[model samples]
Target: MTAPLLVTGAAGFIGMHVCEQLLNRGLQVIGIDNLNDYYDVSLKEARLARLKKHKGFRFFLIDISDRDAVANLFKTEKPSRVIHLAAQAGVRYSLEHPHAYADSNLTGFVNILEGCRAVDAEHLVFASSSSVYGSNKKLPYSESDPVDHPISLYAATKKANELMAHSYAHLYGFPCTGLRFFTVYGPWGRPDMAYFGFTRAILAGETIKIFNHGDMQRDFTYIDDIVDGVLKVFDNPPEADEAGPAYRIYNIGNDHPERLGYFVETLENVLGVEAIKEMYPMQPGDVQSTHADLTKIRRDFGFSPTTSIEEGLKKFADWYRGYYKC
Candidate 1:
């Protein structure tokens, strides 16, 4: 029998989709999440409920930062592979609560590594973010680019996680892959994200804040594309490159950079309601633009994001209206 897969943050937006995809492929999945109120707790529960119906899925509510609980789960499950995705997300929120990032991103990730080391998990894949590219004027950020500077505490912790994972891969010869995702959006996305928030505000007849005077651009990747890229990486474990390590980092992005104004237009078109615009300077932790250099990921895993902004946003808006009864 094939060994079961362990997925941390299985209740989260991307995590839920990943778990569903794994189950559809006939893989046994073990999931863990703390079910924190960072967003709506009911939404998390709803995601979990879907997984609970599947006979192949087993879920435990545990925070990865708790070393003992996480270690116990690893020992008990003996999963063949681990996908670590739980973390304190949001850049502006990180400014107000820096310690959350430390506890979850740093401490939590450490416990995951220890668990993997103890159980000898065959492969470990974790989520990273484009925020780590931070303030780089470089148009398309690549894995090979230097990411020493981070604008927010959230970005810093993610970058640190990648470095820590690389160390483990080097020392233990464990296969580890880190995916640096661009702006991911679709159904079931975090409400704290700009796209989600903007939709809410615009619907409520409130002015949506357009930072950088609406000059920003982003590689808005669809959630399905992100999930497909992640699953592809999970299916194919990294081999030690001539660089002398089995660790790999890939930028999972749409490759199409669209302006903030264009994004808003797309959203407005989908909702069939014009947004009240409130232009503002870029926030302190905000970057002007983000573009992904996906050459390596494409070469490695045939990673191609096929969703266009118009189609993806339309689907998200349709789901949003139905879900919220708007």
Candidate 2:
């Protein structure tokens, strides 16, 4: 029998989607998640329930930060590939709960690296974030850009993950790929995200706060596009080159960026309800805009994001209403 693929954060928004797709391809998947209360536990559970319906899906309630547990699971499962996506997410939350970031992003990541080294995994694909770009003035953030200045603790930790993964890949002679996702949104998205929150507030007839006084833009890539990019990168691992080991990083995002106000207007049109908007100053640890340069991913894997913001939001709105019965 072929070895099962191990996916950390199997219950997460992206993790669940990745797991489902892998399962659909007739591959066994061993999923692990602490199921923390970073957001709605029920939502996470709901995602897990869907994966459970797949015959090839297996789940373990384990936190990657728990070194012994992670090591044991890797030794037992001996997965062919590792997809590490679990992390303490949220830029503002990282500021308030710095310790969470340290435990999950730092310690947990190290534990995962050790697990990969133990199993000599074929490839390790981990989730990075576009937040690592900081307040970069560059129109489209590229993978080669110098990401030395991260304005938020979350971004710093994600940058650190890239560096850490590189060191492990070099030392252990394993292929590693890091994907820096930009503003991922769509069905079954995180409530902390702006679009999700805006939809909720609009339905409640409450005021939606527009940060930076509505002068912001995001390269919102739909969930399906992100999953497509991830799977493509997973199938093709990096090869060792003179410049570095078998390690590479790519930005997974929709290259097109949409302004915040225009995004809200589109959402309003989709939901068939106008939102009461309140303008506010830019929040700390937040950037004015984010855009991803897909040159490398496009050249390497033929990755192309086909979902428009309007179509994606409409799908999200339909799912939102049906899921919530609102």
Candidate 3:
């Protein structure tokens, strides 16, 4: 038997799925999430319900922002590896609730770092986001690309996390791998996401807003692919590299940037309902496009996303219809 792994944000969309996979692999996992009502607590509860069924999965309802709580968890669990995914999400919401970002992404992350430092974990894998690229004109955002400018506070925190992890890895001898996840979507997804929201709006015949007049692009990755890449990276930690930083950062994306118009059309085809798109100019803290250059992850973890948007959206739509009884 191996040491139990500690996964923060275990009840989240990505977190729950990661925990499920780890548990299925016969690994002991202690999952933690504060269960904040960012969107709908019931949805989180539903995700947790599925995880609770696993014998190897243990859960703790605690917020990572609480330094004392996190330190105690680490001291008690003594997990050899840690996966930190808890953070205040959403770009537009970050503008309204900037402190939420600071509390969860900044202060909360400090607590997580302290926990890992205290325990002397073998490795720490955390979630970053494509938003860290900000408004870069680069076609495919690569790990080697500069991330000095972050348009949204949410993106800023993710960028800060990569820096924070690197500094911690440098000061201490622990290995850290940070993953910049692209637009992840699938069953049990976050309601605030465009794909999820589009599904709901299209079902309810509500008008869906199309930013930048449907001219945006995103490398929409599926949840399973994200989980697969994460686990592969977790099993391997960053070591001495020539060009990369003291810590490693990789992009886990579909490597296929889909146009917003096409993505919506795919959704419409999947749900069998045309969307009422309200075209508008770009909103603040929003980017025109996001394309992930997956060379690093591919070479490192053999990460290849197989789910096409059509197939993935069909699964999401079917799940949504059944879950909502629509």
Give me the candidate number with maximum TM-score. Answer: 2
CA lDDT for candidate 1: 0.93
Clashing pairs in 1: none
lDDT digits (tens) for residues 198-289 of candidate 3: 88999999999998999899999889999999999999988856754448899999999999999999999989999888989999999988
Worst 10 residues of 1 by lDDT: 237-246
Decide which is better by TM-score, 1 or 2: 2
Runs of candidate 3 with Cα error greater than 4 angstroms are: 241-246
> Best by lDDT, which number?
2
List lDDT for all candidates, in order: 0.93, 0.96, 0.92
> Against the hidden reference, what TM-scores do the models get?
0.98, 0.99, 0.98
lDDT by residue (tens digit), candidate 2, 15-91: 99999999999999999999999999999999999999999999999998999999999999999899999999999
For each of the candidates, the C-alpha root-mean-square deviation to the true structure, in angstroms, is: 0.9, 0.6, 1.2
Prediction 3 TM-score vs. true: 0.98
Candidate 2 off by > 4 Å: none
